[model samples]
Each structure stands twice: as structure tokens, then as C-alpha cells.
Target chain A: MEIYNYMGYELIEKIRSKEITIQEVIQQTYERIEETEELLHSFVYLSKERALKRAKNLDAQLKNGKTTGKVLGLPIGVKDLICIKDSPTTCGSKILEEYRPPYNATVIDYLIEREGAISVGRTNMDEFAMGSSTENSSYGPTYNPWDLERVPGGSSGGSSSCVASGQTPISLGSDTGGSIRCPAAYCGIVGIKPTYGRVSRYGLVSYANSLDQIGPLGRCVYDVALILEIIAGYDPLDSTTVDIGVDEYTKELNRSIEKKTLGIPKEFFGEGLQKDVKEKVKKSINKLEGLGANVVDLSFPHLEYTIPTYYLIAMSEASSNLERYDGLRYGKMSDDLKGDVYEVFSRTRGERFGSEVRRRIILGTYTLSAGYYDMFYIKALKVRTLIKKDFQNAFEQCDAIVCPTMPTTAFKIGELVDDPLQMYLMDVLTCPVNLAGLPGLSIPCDYDNKGLPIGFQIIGNYFDEKTILNIGYQLEQELNIYRKIPPLTIRGN
Target chain B: MSKKEELSKETIEHISKLALLDLTEEEKEKLSKQLGDILNYFKKLDDLDTTNVKPTTHPIDGLKNVFREDIPGESLSNEEATKNAQHKKDGYFKAPRILKE
Candidate 1:
């Protein structure tokens, strides 16, 4: 029997009941990987032997009555940008072709060592977690399982694709200005980018430090909530992590959405939104209203400046953070090591870093350079202040803000690759959440005429993940769409 | 908005040098135009008067000086440290000479 087809919650019940062994789940997961990997290309590496051995050990422990953490026997696909000690954490860039982290990220320890969730393997991502589409990956673009020719949304695209296609029950994804949420929205699954500093960033590779956050993507909101509970909390290793404490997210999932006020940012629904996406989101808002949630339409004046503020600040930090790859200690250094230090650094980076990576680095360097520093980088930071205030003001009147995750549904693969500005525009509604360091949830709300999923984004106040989650949980119960698997999963099988 | 800022080829070369990236003419040409366009759009910020707005480098307010006890901790060992390096000499990473011989 294909026990892997079950959700994490169901799989846990069955594992506890001894109805199915962990080995059977592992076998079926590998069977699915073997079946779908060719067309989907969701994974960069598969820990087949290790997972098989681990499964046997877990099954033996269950028989021996040994303790297992929550989500025991569940399989998780981790994005390549996160470190998995001794595994190839590629960040989907050839610069780190042979690189393996010596120590597990704090999140990996929580998921694998502490929590007992099994690692299916490292998944793919954008090079250095830069792009919105997984096409920026040196491994090549991951196909959207919903539509073969379309993209799986990116940076965290592989993580989203794996769960949507049912290769793993849940996966880890990092969001630095919508990396996690964008792909989650595009792929038709549940993903959460928690309030900044909520999840420890110790093991996740840095792209933009101030904005980078580690989060989870899952087949449903409950699974995403489950992983968040496991991975969140303070860690001395990551000082940015707060000691604010994690709530019983799964338990709170049943909370009613009545009396909760949701803000509809008028600017989010303005000019660029596609007609179908707008209609579906408005209809979902009506559904929330029908469920007794109060809806308020408010104007967010500074919304137009989000892309510029997000891109400028993010790229500037990314440029500074990425200076570590000198080719001597990590990744594949350029072959022309015979030159002096400067030449070696230039040559190695020039040869190894992808086009998008290099472009951002140069632009970032310019932003921080003399004469332009105040006019560009500092101005972006000040604008970040204004944008952050915009969220603060909105949250004062609402429990959560609801909007379309993307201006449109998933586009064809390679559609916006050459046009960087057009591609950056894809994060229009999503990046503002990151700028404010607030929690954002992308849930599959409705499907367009093409059967492509449209995501409804819920932005909540700092550390108020529960309210947004309760809203998502209530909506999910109302919609009953979590069990709808993508056609590619079935077709490939 | 700031007279439509543009990046010249010389500026790209200079910044590329500072960024330690060697770029071909094609990349230089492309980045010059693309980065120019992006910077121009960023001029939109000037529209809002951020006169007294303090720059927010970190998102969470009131988090500062997260100091801990002054002590050593478990970390990557020497062998593990250089495990992914392509070249090594006597437990140290071997890199090209820093200065011209």
C-alpha cells in the first residue's frame, strides 16, 4: 500500500497504531521519487540508503516503545539553501558544487535530530536564494506540477513542488523577500514566512541577512503549522531569534475566525492584479465575511514603493553577505588560482556565480558605493521605515490583511527570465510582509479558469502567527481543498 | 527623479572591481542598463518625505547587543573546516598569494 500518500497527521496515527511500518512509508516515498523525479526534478540529491536505514531504526524504536518526537516517521524535503551537515547544500549554484556543510543548521537539528522527522533529501532552489522562479537555479528550472510548461515559483520552488506533488509530507523553505511564499503561492500549497526572528537562521545560508527567514511549506496549513512548532524558538547561535515562545499552533488551528477583522489593502487590488486572480480573491474575502470575519477596505499609500525598497535593501545586503565565497574555503573556487588574491577572487566569482547573482552583486555594490550611498541604499532603508509603519498602521485596525499572493497565477517556465524587473514585480503583494518583518501565510484559496491555483495571502502583526493561522485553518476547513493533489503527481506515477 | 540616473561602463567596471567580480563586455553592458533602470525606479522613494524617519536596518525593534558569556564553544574542527576546500596545505586552506611576488 502507498502509505506515503497519507498526510503527516494520518501517517503519525498509523505509525503509532502499528498499521504501517516506517519502512513501508520510506519505500513508497522512494517509489514516488523514482516515479516523478525525471519530469519534476524537485530534488538535488536523495538520501536513499540513509533514509532506508533510518526508517528501519525508527520502526524498531516504535516496537521497543522508545520515545519519538512529533511528526515522527514523517518525511521532509529541505531546500538546498539550508545546510544539512555532510549533505550537498547547493543553494542551486555550481559555485558550491561539491560543498557540504560541516554542521547541521539549527533547523536541521530540530527536524532530524530532536524532532525525529526523516529527511527525504536536499531539494533545489534559486542560486543563493535570489530569484522568485526556480529557473535561477544552475540545476535548471523546476516544472510546476499543476501545469507542466509553467514554473513552480521559486528560490523555494523545489520545496513547494515536492509537497504539492506529494513527494514529501512537508518541506523547509527560506524567505528573504518572498522566496518561500512566492513558490508556495505559485505551487498551490500552504507556506508560512513567520515573523522575522521567529525561526533561527543559523543553518540557513544567507542571501539577505536582515530579511532572511527560515520557514516551512506543506501540503496543508496544519502540516506547515506542525513544522513551524518544531523549528521555531530562540537559539543562542542565531541572536536574531527571539525567546518569545512558540504556541500550540496545531491546537489553535481549530479557533473560529468570527469577529476577527481582516484588512483588504486597496493598493494590493489596484492596477496590476489580473482580472481572474482579483475576482477569486474578492470571492474568498466574501467567504471569510460569510464565516463571520469582519472585512475592512483600507488604503496603503506607500505600497507602490515596496518593490524598490525591497530590491534595493535586499540586493545591498546580499552583496555584502555574499563576499565570503573567495573559492578557498567554500564551493568551487575559480581554476585560475595562480593569480594574486584579487585576481583569484574576481576570476572565481566571475566564473562560478550565475548571471542573476552577479547582477545583484554589482548593483548592490553600486548602492553602497560613494556618492550614491545616501541617495540609494540609505533612502531605501528610510523607505523601509515608512513601509514598516504602513503595516503597523494597518494591523491596528485588523487582525490580518488579506490579498492575492501573486498578481496572477503561475506563468509559463522561462516566461520572465530575461526581464528582471518584470520578474521582481511578481513579489508585489508578498515583499511588503518581509519588509515589515511580519508573519505571512499563503494558502491555496481558489483555482482560475485554467485550473491553476490562486493563493490568498494573510499578513499578520509581529509574533501574531496564531491569528493568521487560525484564519487560514478556518478557511481551509471551509474550502476543503487540501486533499486535492496536482495532476502531475498522478500522471507521473 | 534624480535626472534618470544611469550607470556608465566605467562605473560598472569600477564597481565590479570593488565587488571582486570579473565581467565580460556583455555582462558589463547588460548590468549597466539593468542596474540603471532599477536605480531609476528606486528614485520613487524621494516622493515620500522621510524627514524624521530613522533608517531601519533590522526589522524587529528594540533588539540590540545580544551578548552572551565570554567563553569558547563547540565548533567545526580543523579537518571539517577545510573539508570542502579544493586546495589545502598542512591543515590550512591553500590560496593564491596575497601579494605579487
Candidate 2:
């Protein structure tokens, strides 16, 4: 296999044994990136010089017998929304195109300084992590590696696309209402949205503070587990993070999930779910049953309200979180001061933000406004409680909930861009997990007749990521479907 | 109260102002219609009986204000803080004049 074909954990072992130099891995990665990037459009910024320098330093340390961090010399792609000091964290928006952060996110610090991972580039995303398809990205959409004309899902589309195309073995993405899982499902890879507050949100550019979480995307379940082990922990900087022990996620990967009951949410299999997706998910459930796991039919009474509840709460939080980008402190500024302070704020934001962002902001402000607060915002919060209770009730009957990660596989570019509601519905199955603040993992199970990958989601109770990871690992071993590289990746060979 | 299902153009304009966004005429028209559709969808939440349920502002339960000792520690230097500012003057962010002198 080519060097780029090896997963991050495999590369780390090889590099540590001195069989391959970090420089060789870095060079091969960039070569693959150069070959496939134009067609995939997966990245916004490539830090070639810095990455090579870091790799050279790590290689010297390895030769000198100096101890390096756990994921030594691994190349990783980060979603543009995460702050990396001295890099242009554009968040796929034109407003912050020139803005460079002076501080790294806690997760970046853990990955680079502690884990010895080299960040290869900043991947593209939906602007402010808002849209379900990366078509909302101002830098242009990231095409699915599976099919060039299809979208790779968003707002973390670039992260998932890079992993799927073998451009990067592991990457980081933030999920706010299924940003990570949607892309992971569409691109046919492994991605997890860790339970809310399991990972710190200190440096993440907030879309919806209440729902957003930073997680890992990789080609396999173990790679996802490895990255999660490194990045998940308590951070003093983020008060919302639960002060709990971070498990060695890989330790439990080989454990059997036999006799564990899995809940199949009946609502997820109904209506908008495509037929092929349902079949693949059902087959995966049977595979689990074949592995000695039991399956039970479960119903979430409030499942229909997930989209509305999620949108209301997410938009309300986003309007408040995004109010900080008014051109005064950081983002793009207008040439003229215009009429007044209010005009400067409005004009700069109006001209800089994309239409979807503008629409959400307007909706959010309206929902939170005095006349509508009780009716929309407060009512949504109440429904959010009910959603949480629904998950709690379902978890009482099973170890985890298994469902199709998305309603369908990769949709064509420009397919749902003009229709916002249809695009929002793309997250129908995944957002319920986010709404309830549970850990959700997406791993490729089967493909449609079109040869596009379909993902099955494993959702666990609050902070119980280990259960879902173990379950996903068992199914992944049984299926063994992730080894096929996209035809675009073969072009790099 | 009667069902005020459709969002008016005036309401969208007011919302744009509140969100600190300046919308062109075409955008206003499109947004008004779109927001109305979305709001109509959100109206589904009204059917649920949430009379006694407490609103869940955050996901995790038993979350308290995490307090720490008020001890001085190293902080970001002014240069680092203002490095990304679009307009900086004399080590401070420069903004448009808000009040007349």
C-alpha cells in the first residue's frame, strides 16, 4: 500500500520503529494533497512549510532516542473553524479570511504539543458551521470524493472528504446539529460528535454554543478512538466541560458487545429515509444480532419535533454567539465608517456574511425578540427537555441507539442549496442525538446502487462514548467495508 | 391570540435591524418568505404540552458556575490580543463614534 493509504495509528507505529521517516510521510501526504485537492477542494489553507519543519524536528528527536508524544509524526487536517495559532482560521467565511488567531484551541495544543501530531492544513467547512451541506461555504463547496458532482456534506465536509479521499488519515471537525456526522456519512468514513461538554469548546468558533462539540473524523473506528482519547478531557478554560476522566478509547475497541441490546428508533426508519439507506442499516442491525447482540424496536415520541427544537435553540444561541464579529475587533471591516456605529456594524456584517448566515441570524434575532421569546425560544427549550427525556427513556431499554446516520447518501451539488428546508431535513436522523446531548458515531456500513457510501450511526447515553465506540468497532470488523479508497484517491497513486 | 402565521416584510426588516444586518430589497423579500415558512414549521412545537416542564438551557444536569481563586496569571499581551483587529489605534481597537461629544 502507498504511504498515504496507511491510517494514522499505523503510520505512528512505522515512524516510531524508524522504518519510515516522518519527512517521507509528510512529503507523501502533501503529494497526495496536491494531486487530489483541485478535484476535491477539501482544504482552505495548507501549511506545507510549517508541517515539514515540524516533521524534520520529530525525525531528529526519534533518531536521538528522545521520547515523543503518543501520535508522533501523524499528519492531521483540522476543520477551519478550530483556532490554530498563527494560521488563518477562516471558518470558511470571507469575513475572517485574513484573520489569524494568536492562540491555539486546547484541542490543537493537545494534538500538536502533547500528541506530536502535525497539522497539515485547514479544511473547508460551511461558513460558521451552519449549513448541512458545505455548499454554504463561501470558499466554494467541497466535492465528494465518491462522486465529483456530489457534496461531501457539511459544515465539516472538508474534514470528512479529506479522510475519505486518503488526503489525510485523521482530521478534526465540530458538530452542531450533525455537522460532523452528516459529512462523515456522506463521505463514507468514521466521525464522532462527542457528547456535549465532553470536549472543550474554548477555541471553536461558535455556531450554537449549546449544541456544538469538537470531535474526530478518520478512515476507521480505531483511528477515531485514538484521536478522541487525546482530545477529550476537562479543560479549565471551558466551564461547561464535565470534570470526568478521559478514557483510553482504544483500550475498549476490541471488547465484545455481545448480549448488549441495541435500540432501533422506529421514527428514523420512517418517511423521508431513503429505501437503500434503510436496507443497509437494517442489515447492519442483523449483523450485530449475528454477533450475539439483541435488537429491540424503540420509539421516541418527540422525534418529530427534533428539527424544530434544534433550529430554534441553535439559532437563538448562534445569533447571540455571532454578535461578536462586528468588524471592530477581528473580522473584515468596511472601507468607510459609513453613517454611524450601527450602520458600520450592519453594513460590514451584511456585506461580509453569506446569505444562509444572514437568514439564520435574522431568524434567531426574531425568535429571541421580546414578542416571540416565550412562544418560540422558551417553547423550544421546553421541547428540548422532552427530547432529552425521550432519549433517557429509550436508553433505559438498550445500551445504544442504532440508526441510519443520514436520510440519504451524498446529494448532488446545488441539489438542496436553493431549498433551505430540504437541506435542513438532511440532518433529520442525526440532529436528535445532538438535541439530547449524546455521543453519536458514524461508520460506513454499506453502499447504495450508485456506489456511494452509507453510514450507520451508534448513539450512546451522555458521556458514554465507550459503548458506542465498542459497538461501532465490532460492526466495522464484521463489515470491513472502509478499505476501498475513492477513485479520486487512486489518481494520486 | 390569533395565529399570526405569516412573517410580514416589516417584521423581517425589523429582525434584520435587530440582527445588525442590512438587507437589500431582494434579500428582504426572499428572507421574509423563507422565514415565514420556517416559522410555520416551528409552529409544530405549539402542539406539545410543556406546561410543567422546566426549560433545559444546557444539556448536562447539575452544572454549577465553576469558580476559581482570583489569582493573577499570565494573560495575553495587548499586541497578541489586538493582532487580528482590522483597525487598531494606540494599542486599542478603533470603532466608529457612538455618541456625539
Residue range A189-290, candidate 1, lDDT tens digits: 999999999999998889998999999998788888888989999998999998897998989988778899999989999998989999999998989999
Poorest stretch of ten by lDDT in candidate 1 chain A: A484-493
Chain A only: TM-score per candidate: 0.98, 0.98
Q: List, in the given order, the native-contact fraction of each candidate.
A: 0.89, 0.84
> What tier of docking accuracy does candidate 1 attain?
high
Each candidate: chain B TM-score: 0.91, 0.91
Q: Give the alpha-carbon lDDT of every model.
A: 0.88, 0.91
For residue A484, give model 1's deviation from the true position in Å: 0.9
What clash pairs does model 2 have? none
Compare the candidates by lDDT and give the number of the best one.
2
Put down candidate 2 lDDT per residue, A10-121, tens digits, no spaces. 9999998889999999999999999999999999999999999999999899889886699999999999999999999989988887889989999999988888999999
Q: Cα RMSD to native, each candidate?
A: 1.8, 1.9
